[model samples]
Target: MIHAHLTEFHGLPVRYVDQEAGLTASQVAWRVQGDSYEEDEGTFADTFEQLLEWDDCDEVRALVVGTWGWAHNDDRADVPVRLLVEAAPRLPALEAIFLGDYVSEESEISWIGQADVTPLLTAYPRLKRLDVRGGDGLGLRPVVHTALETLRFESGGLPAAVVRAIGASSLPALRHLELWLGDEQYQGDSGPDDWAAILAGGGLPALTHLGLQDSVRQDDVAAAVATAPIVARLESLDLSMGVLTDAGAEALLSGQPLTHLKRLNLRHHYLSEEMAANVADGLRGVEVDLSDRQDPEDDWRYIEVSE
Candidate 1:
């Protein structure tokens, strides 16, 4: 099974509008090109036109988008990316954007196609957070942005190349980085070595939160992260939504002292009760989240967000 569609983004409730109306700064706007397979009725271009015409368009601070065309079948719809690139100048207060908000009913996480995202960062200097889903044709160029603070990618099968690119990129101000590396069934094939650059914390001086979630080989991540140099500076770590068993828990507990961290997320795991208890006892003061204990049948452990 997959996760639910986003109800909130960047800490704000999501709102979908169709007409000119007053909008608050506390909510983010959402638009999809088509719903129920309508061709020309609702579209990215049409919605953009409508959005620009709103009385309070300039007051909009955040936006969410998904499925520019034929969402369920189309793997690469580069039109929305181009549309956003062109619309950047008109959105004055836009600070955050979320791409690919569809759930399984619309498109699987791995089915959403993404384009090169370097241009968005270049265009919106004020943009602080960017959350993207789907990695099928996803492309990103190493960028240096001063204002960007949070970058996250959600995928059922994140590509190895994309993972390597993120590790190689230079994000000086990025404080939170999360990547959902699903199983190989979709396109996920990255290993611990692929993200070694990120683990080493080369250009990320402000990073305090790291999430290597939703992977099949979570044990490998745990083993490497336990001894990684980045852990020394991190305030929280998320190894959730993956097939983490007692072996992974043991590696984490034995490798480094996690008592300094403020949070450790190990939800939806296959760890034994004893190992789960050990994790809680090991990090006494930390806000350890060990919820969603799984009961795997025939020793088949599963991840949360893979198709």
Candidate 2:
């Protein structure tokens, strides 16, 4: 009955559905609703519980949980972890979950607070994909899960400790990973060295798609990623929605063989028109995206998603 609130995307395209909507999967947001902006009709947990009470709750495949009417004031706000842990048994077929899908109009990504989510990984062993937004109090402890295939952390200011935890994780089945390293002004503190450690590690043996997007230090990240051994094994790489300059593209040009990858996404960058053309020329066969060029006049760089 509540299967309409779920969707599964393999990458840019949707691939799976739980309900027979007779509609293309691309059009569905699969989001659960909350109350009015001024009224506290229900929290994320309240809506989740309502779904869990349904007879076909186990049919839900991919769920996007977001706040309806309230903005989280702190870490311990909206959608308690315990409720999910308790409902795991009922959602046996659940595979993908995107926690905190609030937009700027609803609540800015930076203001969308979160808490430790390590238990959810353990609670839902069948889960294959997980995307989380916000990083205020978000924590993913070093875990050894086998079935998880995709893991993403989207934040305005991703913490250094969380990066270390991901580096220490034992996800042997992971295939796609993305980390949005936002500006330091919003609390993003992880440096290039931290990312270097993650790239050097052998824990992610099955990773094929990698994304280190939306960073103030895009040039540094690009420099590090160009030389990282992980690049050789990836089929697609995403460095979009950040402040990448010509220098960063130069590092990519000289360091790695971009011709082998299926796709390279470098949209929402600050690269010069000449360098953009060069990138397009260099990777002729590869599907390259160089749109949304931003000009930094006052030495100011903007991350794609922030308050």
Best by TM-score: 1
Q: What's every prediction's RMSD, in angstroms? A: 2.2, 4.7
Candidate 1, 247: how far from true, in Å? 1.8
- Residues 1-67 of candidate 2 have per-residue lDDT tens digits of 0113224343322322333256433343345545445554665555666666656667666667656
Error of 1 at 12 (Å): 2.9
Itemize residue pairs with steric clashes in candidate 1.
none
Output candidate 2 Cα RMSD: 4.7
Checking candidate 2 for backbone clashes, the offending pairs are none
Poorest lDDT segment (10 consecutive residues) of candidate 2: 1-10
Candidate lDDT (C-alpha), each: 0.81, 0.76
